[model samples]
Target: MADLVFTVFTSLDSYIEKPGGVFAPPPWSDEVGEAWSNAALARAQHLIYGRVNFEFNKGFWSAAETDPNSIAAGIDYAPKMNALPKTVMSRTLTGDPGWNGRIAGPDIAAEVARLKRDVTGGDIFAFSGAGAAETLFGADLVDEFWLMITPQLFGDGKPLFREGRPESTMRLVECRPLDVGSVILRYRRASEG
Candidate 1:
């Protein structure tokens, strides 16, 4: 079974992007990127995302494929993710003809649960989809969360997490600091209603 994890780069103000909903500059360092990529490749078998992030990354990473080493390992892994299977949690998107996966419905907990038992032993990652994140959180399907927090802040910015009735309680499992003043925090989902 593959675990369901998430990769999000948030600002100190708890925003994942700027006022325009565009993600902030690439704040990942080689070490940070490598660690994330290694962790990604180690446990995640699929890339799940929102339409916005999916499109933005589709263009950003496609242009950097030639020089894999020139980009962060996460970006370097783009091609792999491009070629890998993905599942987007979108309602407005109508087309993804060349995409590696499909858009799923709201009731994804069943599908996610089934994916968890596929015997691949990788992770099913939610790649910056606040809506999907919220949905999964509401469903109590996520096992762990991997949050990459940067030092900067945007007083008015896109939300870093899906807002809902917060889980009864989430337990912190670990925290790692990066050289670029960013920190990665991991949390395990505790008992929920």
Candidate 2:
């Protein structure tokens, strides 16, 4: 069975996004970009996203296709990222996402389950922060988590785990320190769970 993984970049305080819609940019550097490209994006065969993130990524990345070296693309692997198939989970989105993407139905867990079975990709990845990740985690659908912890912290911001999700235990696969004091943590749900 294809495994569902949540790969996200978060602050030391566990915030995914800044509070109040203010952009709290991660400490992104060339080294960090290359590391992400080589480590996560390169291995991914397919990607899944929450509705808002899907739309945002499509617009942002699609426009930078012609200029792979542009700041917006931010990596040498733009083409690969653009080509990967994506499924966007949305209840309100009715049509195609213009890019090589699909709109998943309202039942997020069931749809993800179907994808896990049917996807020929080596692994299915979701970078949905807390929105879809919470739902998937709650349903026990996520098999692994790949979190890149930035060195900085935001005292109050959008958290990676929300208020009411059930607790889950994970087994650490490895923790690697990257450039500029960032760390990438790989963990899988305990087998006995």
lDDT, each prediction: 0.72, 0.79
Expressed as tens digits, the lDDT of each residue in 51-153 for candidate 2 is: 8888777877786677666665765676776888899877778877777899887787888888888877477889685677778777778788888898988
Q: How high is the lDDT of residue 54 in model 2? A: 85
Task: Evaluate model 1: give its TM-score.
Answer: 0.82
- For model 1, the superposed segments whose C-alpha errors exceed 4 Å read 62-76, 191-193
Task: Give lDDT for model 2.
Answer: 0.79
Clashes of 1: 3
Model 2 residue 172 lDDT score? 95
Q: Give me the candidate number with maximum lDDT.
A: 2
Task: Write candidate 1's Cα lDDT for 25-133 as tens digits.
Answer: 6476788867666677666678777777777666666555555554533454666766667777777876663467677766788778877887385678888556666
Instruction: Say which candidate scores most in TM-score.
Output: 2
